[model samples]
Target: MTTHYNVQKHNTIYQVKDRILIGTMPPKAQVIEEAPDYLGNILKYFSKPRTLEDSFKFITSNSSLSEIEARNLVEELIENKIISNKKFDSDNRYSRHSLYFDLIDTPINAQEILANKTVGLVGMGGIGTNIAMNLAGAGIGKLIFSDGDTIELSNLTRQFLYHEEHVNNFKVEQAAKQLALINSEIELVPILESISDVEIFDKYFNECDIIILSADSPAEIHEWINSAAMKHGFAYSNAGYIDSFGAIGPMVIPGKTACYECYKNDGDLYKFLDNGQELPSNLNESFQAPSYGPLNSMVAAVQANEVIRYLIGVERKTEGTRLLINSQNYKIYEEVFTKNENCKKCGHFTHHTENLHASFQESSLTDVYVNERENDSFNSILLDSMMDRLIKVLPNTKILDIGCATGEQAIHFAQKGATIIANDISEEMLEVVNNKVNTLELKGIKTLHGDIVNLNIEDKFNYVICNNVLDYIEDIGTRLSKFKGLLTENGTLIVTIPHPIKDGGVWKKEYYNGRWNYEDFSLQNYFAEGKITKSRENKDGETVISSIESYHRTTETYFQTFVQAGFKVVGLFEPQPPNIVAETHPILFEKCSHIPYFQTFVLKKE
Candidate 1:
């Protein structure tokens, strides 16, 4: 028996002037124009599911084309998906969905894929109810939704899932009832409890493929949902409104795109509103933003469309971006974000450590570093402060210098009759230290090469100097504890790092009222700990540029880590370049004077 073929359902063919057109409606529509006359007859005969031999016979009888020409046209149509050999059941409820899937370029049917996915919705309010109805209409297999609020007369303005009779009933229960009427084949699980904690997500939505958060209450609910989504390793999306703007977006896939915290770290609203301080007691009262039925439905349509597109294995527009739609002017704006390597929630700390080790190992970097340390006025001022502290304990004290590049501090300590152990990650840098020790005949100076965190040394020292090293180290508390253990009972640890304000801040130019103005330097995501990458030219004026990576941490975090590690802060200093730099390098002097360039902490083991 021969197989039969038919033109796909919902396709239309017509003649425009001397040309014929075959087309279908979008979401992945196929269109063919300027067809020969014989091909039109072939399509007409194939509309009723006829075998290839019958189509060829009918085309030849109706038109002047040869049998071979008709056969080739039918074969090409099947290849292009304008016609299908697979039979579709037209009597089923999802017949139109199957026909829609026929236009897509996937190996499997999309409607079938939708039937296998389980979606969990967090709220049953205006946006949530609309999304639920849309997903149910699209034949989503199972929906697990929760809401604690009871429907009131005000809710009926935007929430379509409830009616006048459902005025006093719980939203989840009424939503499930209305959704069941739309599609009896779908599975609906409704919970009448408000989501207040992150643990509730794992309890209910553990098995869901995707969880969408539409609740706008508690203000911190998005963070809780993000934590749960990241912990469970599931895809999630956020959708809601703020004032007249409806926001949908940032469909997050675990390990693939940026999470909610990454967006929060870079979002504009977060930059101004999140200052790590509690608001006044009266200011903490709950307030609701404006909401309308049309706006809710519009946002819900896009959100639901994104979920469907993701389920069916298509490219989603909201991945790693937030889409804000303005209702007044119908303008759309987008905010794009990426996975932050320093994001406290979804960032990886090991990659930054690995990059730091690889970067300092290069000889070019060490050469430039040594040259800068010798000539940089900023370094001269930092060394002055360091020497002032070390001079009091020299001439018989044991000093352990972590990250002692080129043995600058170790050689000075050894020359003053102090025993020294210089530790560094790069062997090339340690070789330079050894070369200086051999040339100067510096006694009591030993070089140890490896990451300081992993190296084991039994000898205790009176002073441990960690110069510009904490910025590269991720686990500060653990490293501080180890440093405390490596010191004598009354030992002191000296740490120097680039000031967080100068390292993490950015200067942006704004144009307002028809003029451009340079704003004061503002710290971007100052409280969010993450890896920062900076690029600079080498001192030799070479065309090649070197990139440096370091972690940004606030002053409070460093102080807290020191206190937790049983250390007392003896001194905290923000050093400025010496006065001579103003006459020598005026540009560098201006910046160093205006901004706190380096932060030094003198901590004592208690």
Candidate 2:
């Protein structure tokens, strides 16, 4: 009697006898029994990659063999040297070779099997090399690996495939060699450079089926990856480790899920950045603990696991999501985030405007001092510097402050001669602002309870101020795009996010918060138009990690989204911490100025 195994839509089905097996077949791995050496031939099959144990698992699953018979068959394959016996364990449990191949057990038709697949890797370290080996071993006909550096002896800590003999070899090249040796049937290509270069990015992006970002280049590189992945509609995976913890997942299905950019700029980055600590440099070098090797392998293994599932027709139920790992204590945490409608990379911003401009609303005397002295100092400095800049340029302007938390900025601008409209999704926040307005007898300031995405005011404003709010927003691009709609023909939008690039305390701030608090997002009094909270941890203490409506944008990505949404560049300025306290480089952008920090951009809708 044959038993039917439940399988995904496109998986292949195999009926050996009393048992059933389902999975995708490598492109050229047809079931031809007459050729002889079934086990050996199976090991050699590769249009993609496959391991010896994978074959055993498939054969046993599909055969009518009971446990005893399956064990005997496995033993036979091992004795015949068709498959090797090795113990693979991570976080304590021994992992069988078959465990690594489970992601591909799905039925797929010939047409689906033949489709070309392209993959990208940002880092070429242990996790990266391992992932490559797994895919190449599986028969992914063509392969590409990118890394600017050559192999070094220090890499031996966990980068298993490279050795002292391979020192000075390009990492990608060495990785290619090891992969070729593992399975000569697979083709491999190595890109010996960084992904930071735009030219390099464009070259490899168009041809990729899925981009696996395992490299730890920088926060900015992630934006480029997100931009390419979203613009091309290809799947992208962000996989890496910080300390003992790591994460691996995709960014293909948009809107329905959070893209990588969101993960980087949203609370996660903030938490990671603020964690106030860095992994010991030597841990990844050749000097640290045995844990490095196994840990890196586990990360790579998980990444390959996800990739095989995607390729062999496993519906990635967790696509566009995050899988967080804590190797320190051995805990795996999964966080599901939503794609921001205002995402700077793929959000709704390219539909309007062309010119870029910059301006700020005026505030009244009392409005500037609403927060008690302690809280007001930091905000006051930012406001004073910003307003001073605007006053020198567009003196008499209309301004809107999104997430006007307590309407402090609005009050400040009102005193400075600009008509200010402050908006916040929180009624309590608005009430506080109104109460302060009453206390200060501040006029020329209008308070509105609204969301940045749906601020339906009739008239356009000359300037928009989004301070510290961008990081918490769901879609930075969508919010920026809406800012475009709120702008006059030459209006400007000024947004300030946590200084993700700043050093010292800035970096320390991320770690202080753990993950970030998202519990309050459901409370209407906190944010009226809040999105759902999937997972949130107390992030680094620098910023409040709210699971409400927030998104972060890299300096470049933010500018690009602005330009795409019909805004022209002007001047960019980064804020410097008072000369005394060390601060991350500030980037400022005016409509057209291009400096790195104080990233102040001036824009006008054309």
Candidate 3:
């Protein structure tokens, strides 16, 4: 079979007498044209797909080159990734982006990674709108943005997504509409509201693969985003501009880098997390550093560059370093900042940092649950204990078990005469559940594979259960709202998150990433939220260790999301280990009773 080839759109070809310059950017070029006139002629037509036979025939008719000579030249270009069946040429939408596909040393799969991702933009202003459009132009598939303000004539200096006609239209809505027009292939969702609290702010964070923070939001709100990102283990970028000077973060990755709190707290800076109940305003405004269009554009473009590099499998160069751009002389400079050891957001927090290399989506990468979900004794300890608590509040009607790995709870519930939907992100786990459903000939149970945020279905459920998933979810508030909407009038939502108040707080050592020693221990739990460490031994008697990230919103933020979503919590259960384990491990029970391994919320839609 013959393969068609096309030149990457971004490649700018320069043909001289003895040298060939081919690159998207003029500064970088590679030699493709030597003295061979046939080679240059055949390669120049790569903007559209063509076959070797077609190239050979064209070369023979125009340049007096032999068919064999043309064949060898085309093969050489294919080997150099200059042309192939990679198909960046098909879509006229990506005609400009074709240069990026050609210039970046990363593979063609990077295109898929960027196109399939969804991002959240917290402010749809100058920087935010620019960043959003840049990403959509680069083939980002989905974006959700928020801005309460309407377009004003004053905004025209920087916010180019609007004009004199869009004055009364909401910024978010206009940005979304404009971006959609540019790339109809992209999904643009807009929120015409302000982010007043953690609950409202978190909803956007929940749905995005990575959240971007830009202009208009206060410092205090940005602090919460940093905390939420670390608590949920998602990466976020902070970008903004003022006057001819502008800056883009130090994109924060929870366990891998120091968060915003770390940067401010370095020189005994007052920690925002330590403030009392009310949100504090940043009165430290020294000057109103004025900004213009050119500055905002430069900062946003760099931030988007960092975001794209991160989406693909490229090593992140901007971590713990902010890129400062000066429009005065149009110079770019890097300011390196080291990760703080006593960082409030992630310093005392401990989790497996290896997953930072992957996308922020919760992936079921390890197959540890493959055979385990099939066992009859699967998670029996928590299953039995939580079942007793669940039966009290959860109605026996239609139920949805989200993050239900291998139908452990869903299968059990279905057997007890309750209809259930077993949803999980892992297809392998679902396959196991399906096999068990077939073998036992089970009824009243079905399987759906998807991420909880985007899984669309009719809204008629009596009960919704989300278990052990909050640590990986950036926005709990938005998810709760969706669950509330899905429920019947009196439907119940059963949410279980890792508890900071679980029993047996004793620290122990294991093979890798075990409990922290005294120095790190004293520095932990300073905030209302942080990581909780645990250990287990594998079949080979080798100890394996991991950490669970838990946000202490109940004790910290007063569970404001429930009220905002019009939910009333009827029951709250903190269950300890069964009596038998407590009797066997008396010391463990005594010390850890201060914390429960898990906490449950039984919320009824009002």
Candidate 4:
């Protein structure tokens, strides 16, 4: 059988000065200087599918070239992708897509590849709706999109998928109807619900090939989606507007590129936009930027183009880079981002200096931690025990509360007429503490931010309180010495840490004599003493809520380190859950009573 070849539909042959330029697109074009007259004539034969033998016969009859020379010239054209033996289905809706993809260097079954990919879209307004439309037109196999908002008259300015009749209808439902009309071959799963937690992504988008976030609500949605992308290992991108500019990407392929959190943490462009400036409270909730139709559509088109490129196995231009387009000048600026090795969301470091701060800064986890400390009987008992020693010298005493998460202990001390310096590594936690301080008008407490190891403080204090912080530090002896230096002679040091036994053990439940006991625990690496990483589970015991890293040290190591740092151990206690826990949280109380989870110590500088 004879093989047939045809010139690409988009390809063009033109003359520049005396040279003939034959190419499809800008960079893909090539020049043939002093070209033969038969070259143009031969390409005309390839305008439509024709056998190489027929083209060779034409070349031999028209010119003096032999069949072999004609064959070599045709092979060169095929190799350069100037012509191809592959026939595109002209009747297909995506036929143009196949022609455009032919210009790309990678071999792609454009329509088939896009028809197999699932895209998860979050948001159904402005940029999101446009993205959905673009993807639908490009023949994406399935779209799982979510939005709780109803269409409004204001949305009509930029959200093109809806009409006046769609006003007050749920955005997702209306979007699904409109998208189906655009392409009935694609599948649409419209969810009429607002996404607040990261866990929702696991439930809805786990099977998606890529997830795009265009929603700008709930403030922390970017962080949540980034976390989800990292966890599920899916490609992710975000497109939205920033005031007058349209922002698209930093397209993330988990482990292969910088994630959304990486941009927030270290990207220079992100920092410039953030800049620690607080917007007005009223504006924060109701501020609406002017959403022009052209700007939104332009941003959405570029974003969708990149997504389609990724699905079709072509290089995505936005990978690890964000494109910011100026609405006024129409200038597009690319901001490249690199993955942060210590980023809390996607970092691999187990002993990262900022790991603890990053863990505590997560809004959801911080909320849970704050609530647990405030209401849990076990934490209440621990706080009471620490306060017992401070009550004796509270009035007019100078104290430093290191690693003060939310300033709970510092606020308590300040209320008792003690001058307190509350210090923490997490900026978010400090913000919460500052809010409380301003609300209460507490003048005795001052908030200090930074890692304690590098924190510069000239004043010595009567007491230095380090609670639940030592477990995350690698060298307790050195940190203890620093604590000693921050204290006056004979000053007290109060420390609380996760008990070595509990921190190093793996707990399991065993049925004994037809009754289940949850206290069967064994130490996995109690004697080894190094960094330990654990997954914290939610109440359901199924979902992994978060991962935390801590250093495990033996009780003997802790005591020896204290002695070596010129401190005398005045007291040591294994704190037990308060009796009220037996009634309030019977299960927790029972398990905690049998095994100690926390250890507290009071040391005096010698």
Say which candidate scores most in lDDT: 4
Model 3 is weakest, by summed lDDT over 10 consecutive residues, at 512-521
Query: Could you tell me the lDDT of residue 348 within candidate 4?
Result: 55
Candidate 4 residue lDDT tens string, 1-606: 777889877778776565778873567877888988777777777888988888778878888788898788888888877788888788989888777777665566678888999999999889999999999998999999999999999999999999999899999999999999999999999988999899889999988999889987787788788888888888989898877888888798987877765666443232344553433245365666678898899889989999988887888878887777878877665666767677777775322112101232333656655656555535565566656655455456899999888777788889888899999988888898999999999999999999888988998999899988999887777788789899988688989888888888876853222123465778787898888886553221222345688898899999988998998898888877778877666556666788897888899987
- What TM-score would candidate 1 get against the native? 0.56
Clashes of each: 1, 118, 13, 0
RMSD per candidate (Å) reads 20.6, 24.3, 24.8, 25.6
The C-alpha TM-scores of every prediction are 0.56, 0.40, 0.49, 0.55
lDDT of 1 by residue, 463-548 (tens): 99998899987778888888999999988888888899888885453322112223466777788888888644332222123567
Q: What does candidate 4 score on TM?
A: 0.55
Give the least accurate 10-residue stretch of model 1, judged by summed lDDT.
349-358
Rank order by lDDT, top first?
4, 1, 3, 2
Full-model lDDT for every candidate: 0.78, 0.58, 0.67, 0.79
| Worst 10-residue lDDT window, candidate 2 | 503-512
